[model samples]
Target: MKSQLFTIAIAAFVASLSYARSYANEAKSEQRMNVLFLASDDLNSWLLGDTNRYAGKVVAPNLTKLAESGVNFKRAYTAAPVCSPSRTAFFSGVAPWTSGHYHNTPGANSSEPLKSALSMAGFFKKAGYSTAGYGKITHGWDQGEHWDEKIGHKRDPAPPGAPLTPSGRGEQDWGPIHLAEEEMNDTLNVDNAIHRLQQEHDKPFFIACGTFNPHMPWYVPQKYFDMFPLDEVTTPELREDDLDDVPEWGVELTLGKQKYVDSVFEHGLHKEGVQAYLATTAYADAQLGRVLDALDKSPYRDNTVVVFLTDHGFHLAEKHHWQKATLWEEATHTLMMIRAPGVTPAGGAACERFVSLLDIYPTLAELCGLEPPDYLDGRSLVPLLRNPEAEWQSTAITGLTSKGGPTWHPYLSIRSETGRYIRYVDGQEEFYDTSKDPHEWTNSIGDPEYASVIKRMRAAIPSPSDAATPLPEVLKNTRE
Candidate 1:
């Protein structure tokens, strides 16, 4: 009887140990954070502002709500003001000046040095997370292999509506579509993301949802157009001689695209174009709301990190320019907000310090307690995340190659908290005191008082040797 009782006691002890071990493993799994990366194409920072000039004119309630819940980098700028290069900088943690990928057609493989480098998705996948992406994430380059599961790029069909302008400028045209919202490409992408969020997964997942709205050919339901009536639409503040004080190179860049703006005004489509942009922006916001709602309902909601940013800013006849590719404030500034479950405080906070999109990779790695690649050019934004008012010493850098110009001829711009400085390869320069001239209407490069400021900003640009190699023979002839 005594022997049998001792054996039963030993058996019970072993069973208790097994149960404790199982619970430990489960807790470890639960602690691993999931990542949800959201991206939009050609979204201007002006549209996201509530106190700026365009405030209350655009409707994006979901985005506004998200900003309230996270930390919004109010002055976040892109590494490059173009789609492919900006996205590339975020993924590879390499700046355009370092990779020479100034256009929208180059891929990670295009740069020999980055061929084997792991993208953000690839990094998470290697670390045992299930990674997936949908819509326009990598420009025209195919990053399908980098993701464990990916939805191929989808092109939106021309909406069955009349052209707003007579130019009928292919993808640049905008009109109201006559189809259901469910048929929209952006809506379909959101649906795909929602389905993935609802599925049960044994491992943490990294899901990327990219929306192509307000990009071009802004086609959405007529109801969206109705949101902004023609009479109520407000154009951005424009100066008739905005480019007069600018340098020759700067003036040339503005004049080259003045024709597009001329066409819009000539056809009396300026108000209509602005209306289309606001409407498409609203449509994108609705899709974002759907994804956010799905996540809130999912079990992983408490452990997930959400990041939303635009590839780059868009120009709607601002600074006499109609599109992106210029180094001006309108084209370089973008929207960036991050929501970390426990690290970020509940109430939305704004960080006014200068930050580049290149910091996204290192920021994620630091948040997850993972080691980032040694080649990352951007410093981690973890410090700013922890304390928005912390003293930061970094500057935002942006680069652009002239449209249809030689690859070696690139312009680099650097922005600090107080001023913006631009220098072309040909020795031309532009300087703006952001505090005094927010619209960058006046050039202060020649002012003696700003000589010290210009000297400091000029020192921030990368040396010629640090810039990316020229495009290959096959890609050199490609136009924007």
Candidate 2:
């Protein structure tokens, strides 16, 4: 009895000492980072030198400057093809399959949002940081009431083209614009974001400014449209038989339910649509410059951690499809850039490891010295940022669920460092190799040469499926 009492007394003393030590450290670490999260619409890694900065592509000068001062994640991917799920994953630190959100929608899914305070805005609030979101916060909603404060912006001033509202071909009267700038519907999101950032706040904050240029309704100001003339632009090449070598599942996805002005695609939209997308992208990049400008002038500039990404990717008649919603590189692959006070490497170093957007939470936690909840699906990326050349896990997964219309393709695909695997619900499949076919033109589903490869990728689907809507039937027939 005497020994027990002695032990209890000593334990109490140690606990008190530990608490004091923690308190002391917390005081010193109070200099936490302010987060400046820049989310652009439909942006992709290919545009930002995430993997390789192509010689012919337009360089994002501001983004390049950011890379010079931070690390760029080359193989990073979004959780879903559209905006909502991707943003949800980042805010919630969870994947779409688990969150019951795989499309760009406004409300809660059957499951809680990936991050549960209903949104990431709430997460920051609980951590004692002021949270503000501008631009596209939820897919359709402006900043939510959940944020400590919310503001919004919209791109263009005109009504959506005729195609979207009345008849599918109604917008043909507006002449033509590329895919990106056409979505400039309204709200002056950039200006609102800047205004919100300039407002005084009681604590360090999480400021998310989304740029809409690259989403859809890809219409840009006349000034930016003139910057890239159709004559000087060369269409990114496509092989006439690009789909021949690809698996049926892969080819099937590239074909979908997109309509052009007056049903003109069968006649011709490749020229009018594709080049406009390129131009619109250039304009979007310019808007990004605006947000960065705001950050450069803000009081929190020195202490902020800036992370940028797109919801997913777009398909401009790539597989013969004009909209988003697929598991291919053009749909799942994305751009992610992060610059923190003392953590990111300089000179635009590239991290080739496959990382999911869900990693954003833990990575920010590491940089800010905060504790992350235990249920997150992504691991911290601090190590990868520090050493971009280090070894990492081989594959990154992406999910897709249709919003509406015919669902003919696979919903889940696992992209390895060098290959891709598409699995359908009814046992169909598609596969590709990055080394031999960067555009995923060839389908080798039943090819004997790739049987072992198929076997390996097939083994990767998570033991317990995270999504209920399995891959579609047409996609399955393409599998080996």
Candidate 3:
């Protein structure tokens, strides 16, 4: 009888231990914060902060409100200027030079470091959170497999008689479509986010909603276009002789898009294009506003951490270029806002420290009480979030990879608080004192006064040897 009692006691003790562990895990998950990750494609700093280039031109009340509610990094930059590479670099927590995956067509699927690194959603899912993603989180590769629930991105439907602009590049056109707000793809993503917020989640959640508007072929409802009258739209400041002082590669970057610029001038569609872009941006903001509204109404509002950013900035005729892929300020400088409920200062704070999208992985990991993998190249921005005026000793590095000849060329730029230094693959250099020349029209690499500044910036750039991985087979034939 005693032996049978002893066996029953052992079984009970083992079950009790298992229950204790499960209870502890449940409590830990409850204590942790939920994350709401929001992203916009090809969004610039125009509507975000006090120091943006276009101060009052944009009609983005939602973006302004969100910026007012969080720590807005005024100097936030992308890892790369292009969509695919920038998204990959930030999502993988690896630098572009390290991955050697730069273009949209060929991605970093083959990069060993990227393949091993835990994606943002993957990390949260591993930490027992229910992860769901919608819209353009990972650009070319949607990364649907990484999330427990995913709704792949869909582009806004093209209105009848599309190509509002008559450029040969059809996707470059922009105008308003006739679809209802509920019919837009971004609206669908926002609706998904709203529905997720409304659901009763058993565990902490990581929800990502990405908006694809304001990227290209910018089409929204007619009401958005009506918001920005074509006559009232002002084009970005342009220097007619901007290319005079640029390096050969830099000039080539502009010349490559000369056809688009010529088309704009040829058809007198400059102001029209600007109006379309602003309208599309406003449309994106509206979707974000809906998501924010749902969150505000949901039970998880106070406990959820919200992060909003863009994959990269777009160049609307700045630097004499019409698109991204150039390592210039216009293409790299973007908007990044984070609101950690109890941690961030109420009513928003502006962080002027130079930060990169690459820092997001570690920052979210630390914010949610998860241990970050040591392989991440970015440091946690939790300190900056807690204290916006914190002293930061880092500069944001943005790069672009283009094949100039037989080998790929990595164009790199280091952006500091006071200046910017760019180094092309062929050893050509350009340095600008951004504090004095915000437009970066003058290249002062040969100037003797800034020799030490250029030297330090040059030393910070990753060596060509560090870019060991070659572009995937998709990009072998043509230059990006």
Candidate 4:
């Protein structure tokens, strides 16, 4: 009987050990690096450091803190400048030229059918990661349908119409408030993120929180506006002869947005627009701080990775432009800040490699130890992130062509480390020695001295692939 008892005890001990092993494995899987992807609407690189010279225009203490803890990429770009196509390239890891996604519509109309694409979210979900996409996941995808849970009833509905404010058309306000009053609304989105965080999910989370502030009609609490006095707000250096050397193409691109950017020429409107952008940015920064604060107070603080970016840069009366969709430096560049513990070098390590939104997929894939699919157009920026002084520098490309525009020359821009090359497909080109002329006042495209540099920059264009694929058979048979 003693021997029998001994055997039973051994068996019990083995079972206990097995159970402990299973629990440990489960914890490891559950502890995958949760992501807090904070995207801004049309935010540019200039607004981050004193780089844009306007960082002080807004008091974004939270973003400043976040940057203190993370790495802010000084030179980051978008594959395309337009919203839909650029956003599409962000997910597909390729350019719109190849995907047949020229404009916001076409294949990526508001209603799309790709339930499963090479999107980062789809990729993460497939790898046992629980995804939560809130507010503007991408330009093409059904943002609500894409996430496991959405913020509002539908993914992209205007919140229950609140008491509408006056057509505060000309100037920027602190927002969600009025000209006189300084009320605020933080619960709309930041609270939603916190609520999602509180929920219990077995899989690690990939939360994308995109803020629509500072996009247009910049709205924030008047409190934020009070932070930036109008007279103190620094404006873009407005030169009278800014466009003298700019070609017809560049001039056209700059002046085209005159209609949409309504507040540019209004009385002290430029100041308000700048103030509004800063106020909206500061407000968004506060909203982000809430998320970061929550993460710090939660069980997932040390293990989570945070990525903040903007779709593209917004133009506030600069060069007479309001929004993006241009191939200029302001429009082509984006705001990219990442905070991944143990992965990203902290304390404002600036990386100047020519990278686009397309790099996001491979970078995340490498960081998380996942195998990226074969069809992605961008390569992993892991090596560069590891070594800030990475040597392999290539130029990033952005294209611009409106369906109804008079000038048929597709605006193509190549932003390199040393200089910039902008050309219309029809042969008109502008070359700016960014090393010397950062303001891009001089056009040296046809200059004999810079002939070789121009040739090299032009050849940097990605070799045509299936993107150069011929048109559909039905189109071939259609009458012109």
Best by lDDT: 3
Give the CA lDDT, 0 to 100, for residue 90 in model 4: 74
lDDT string for model 3 (207-297, tens) is 9999998888888888988997776787888888877777888777667788898898788887887888888889899999998888988
Model 4 residue 358 lDDT score: 75
Q: Which predicted model would earn the best TM-score?
A: 3
Model 4's alpha-carbon lDDT is 0.65
Off by over 4 Å in 3: 1-30, 141-143, 403-408, 469-480
* Superposition TM-score, candidate 2 onto the true structure: 0.80
Off by over 4 Å in 2: 1-28, 49-56, 104-108, 112-118, 140-145, 153-155, 159-187, 241-255, 258-267, 404-410, 463-480
What digit string (tens of lDDT, one per residue) describes model 4 on residues 316-431? Answer: 66666767777777788787777777666755476767777777787777666667775566677766666667666666777666543322235667888757887775567889
Candidate 1: clashing pairs of residues: none
Tens-place lDDT per residue, model 1, 1-480, is 999999998997799578546634653555567899998889898765642335338889988888888889888899888888889889877677776667764444566545545688887887778988987777644446668778855767886555655844768788778679999889999999999999998988899998989788888998999999888888788888887887777777777678888888888887888888899999998998899989989998878889999988888887778878889888899999999887777786988888999999988876665667776778788778767888889589998776644445678899887689999868889999888888888899899999988998988787544444443321232211
Residue ranges of candidate 4 with Cα displaced over 4 Å: 1-31, 53-56, 105-116, 142-146, 152-187, 259-263, 346-348, 403-410, 463-480
* Comparison by lDDT, 2 against 4, better one: 4
Q: After superposition, how far is residue 33 of candidate 2 from its true place, in Å?
A: 0.3
Window of ten residues with lowest summed lDDT in model 1: 471-480
Candidate 1 at residue 307, lDDT? 91
Give the alpha carbon lDDT tens digit for every residue of 125-201 in model 2: 67788887777655642226558656565445444443432323422222234334434532356666677778776
- Tell me how far the alpha carbon of residue 431 in candidate 4 is from the true structure, in angstroms, after superposition: 1.4
Cα deviation at 407, candidate 2, in Å, is 12
Q: TM-score for each prediction?
A: 0.89, 0.80, 0.89, 0.81
